[model samples]
Target: MADSITTIGFDADDTLWQNEQFFRSSERQFAAMLAPYFDGDDLMDRLLAVEKRNLQYYGFGIKGFTLSLVETAIEVTEGNIPASVIADILAAGREMLWHPVETLPHVTETLEGLADRYRLVLITKGDLFDQERKLAQSGLGDFFDAIEIVSDKDRSTYERIFTQHGDGPRHAVMVGNSLKSDVVPAIEAGSWGVFVPHELTWVLEHVDEPVSSSRFRRIETLRALPEVLAEISAAYSAA
Candidate 1:
């Protein structure tokens, strides 16, 4: 797989920088903010449902999440929630957008090593403005030859990104944490999927096993990525 892959696509949020954990933190704050009306657990359940339902309409990222928080507050509390609470939710959303983009362990060095060997791309799904801001702050942005802030991570989306970048799906390898977003779709699109497990993945991105796929594999961390590529190259060379 590594020998065939000339282009490597990375999923930004959790794959590269700290994203979902901050959202989780903000959600905890959100639950606490509305503690007067509903149980924290119940609020979490309700908010998650709202977020899932709103994904199409609001799309992904902080703004959509903030709006969902407001709507969930209204729904669970029957619109009796205070304006100050609404204000606080909006404020929290802003804070999340402006939060420092903390690169994951070995992300910088990994990208640095890969950049010279493959055509690197940042293929992330989120609100454009927020994604762009985070990319700029991440300091690892310069490594990518192309950047894609897509609305969703689907088969067609992966196909289109590879096409636009002039990289055939057969020669592309998509790496990320989410099984649903990064692995499955890339595999379904006829590309290779490399799952790099993250300890704190968002519930929304969870999916079942990639059982039957020969083109799919998992590496424990970013530090292991280069060796995987090297192994692929070596195996193909020996053959």
Candidate 2:
């Protein structure tokens, strides 16, 4: 229950500010750029495959994605991708890196309300520089007790975060859009996992929905979170 929990970790990107939507838009643009030589859907699918394969080498971020886009274009076009097309791909990456960090509806306000009463930490996974840049520009950095931009989210990662915060798993909760990245691992690591679904999740992040567990919950939106926590805490206190 919420009352028993002392530390809360939030995933950045879609959970706090706009992220995947930009990537989705960029993918469409990339596909359109290559529409002459390759079918758009096929091109996008190839690009996704390249991204998946390159994830280990490039990790996650705009730079790697831009590189993958270029690589995909070259491969699809048999090394005939024009310089102009390459330039456009690079420009898209720049636009993404420079895009305004728009905090989602009620995200900052929710953090504000919760920060006053509980320890809040940001536990996001991405390129270090890009993640830090977004956090600096987000204007909500002051609300967090700690910030952890990890390479990935797994059970060990969540366990370490809990240990670092001195809360352990029983006293911590993780909230985010990706069930795979945020909820399941946190729950497996002995913490509460709250799934806040987003409309435009990447297909790669999808998994079967998690069944309800003692420390797992699914909520429609962050707007209902405060009340949810209150109810959980009340139940905890009763127990």
Candidate 3:
């Protein structure tokens, strides 16, 4: 029998639109500002370490990002940095507000094509209001059958969404940029996953291990997804 996929979950941030570009630009500014106190490598390492440790406390979003900046600044500066420096970092974080739209070269056409063959769901994690506003403005909202703006992407979150949507693990697929947030969880839940590399994926999203399963695949662009899905469907049919 052919493997049946009824629902496809998509990540919104870097997957659908230009998200990490802003973060990358802000990170460069942050490093420049901290140049007097620390070199770029040292400052970035410190910030990455701090963010890894604080993921539980801050979860994901602007709040965590702001805290990472504050914590890193205080630690590296030995509490001697001026209040203005911290204020600037906070301002930078606040400026990260994004307007949603497609980022890939041909994202709209790809989503339009996929929507015809699969049930689509927008699964993103972030500040509720900000995410909602982006979706509303993106003009791509109509493509999704459901929108899940979550605080975290974990096993529980995936399970809950699958259950709520009446989708079985075997019949669902997740497509996104982050391996840590999107791919692993989907695989753990017995769902297929598609990884689309972005220009500015966070260090936390990196995965060291090779993807060994036939169900998990990687593509370079959103435009290539329709063909990949067709291939997957063909393979399943053959089996």
- Candidate numbers sorted by TM-score from highest down: 2, 1, 3
lDDT of 1 at 64: 95
Q: Positional deviation of 109 in candidate 2, in angstroms?
A: 1.5
Instruction: Indicate the TM-score of model 3.
Output: 0.89
How big is the positional error of residue 36 in model 3, measured in Å on the Cα after superposition?
3.6
- Give per-residue CA lDDT, model 1, range 89-206, as digits (tens): 9999999989988988999999998999889989998899999998999888899999999889899998998878846787788999999999999999988888999889978988
What ranges in model 3 sit over 4 Å off? 1-3, 37-41, 98-102
What is the C-alpha local distance difference test score of candidate 2?
0.88
lDDT (tens digit, per residue) of candidate 2 on 36-107: 877645777788899999999998889999999999999999998899999999999999988989888888
The 10-residue segment with the lowest total lDDT in model 1: 230-239
Clashes per candidate (backbone, < 3 Å): 0, 0, 0
TM-score of each: 0.95, 0.95, 0.89
lDDT of 3 by residue, 137-179 (tens): 7788999888999878887777777667746666778889998
Local distance difference test, per candidate? 0.88, 0.88, 0.80
* Model 3 residue pairs with clashes: none
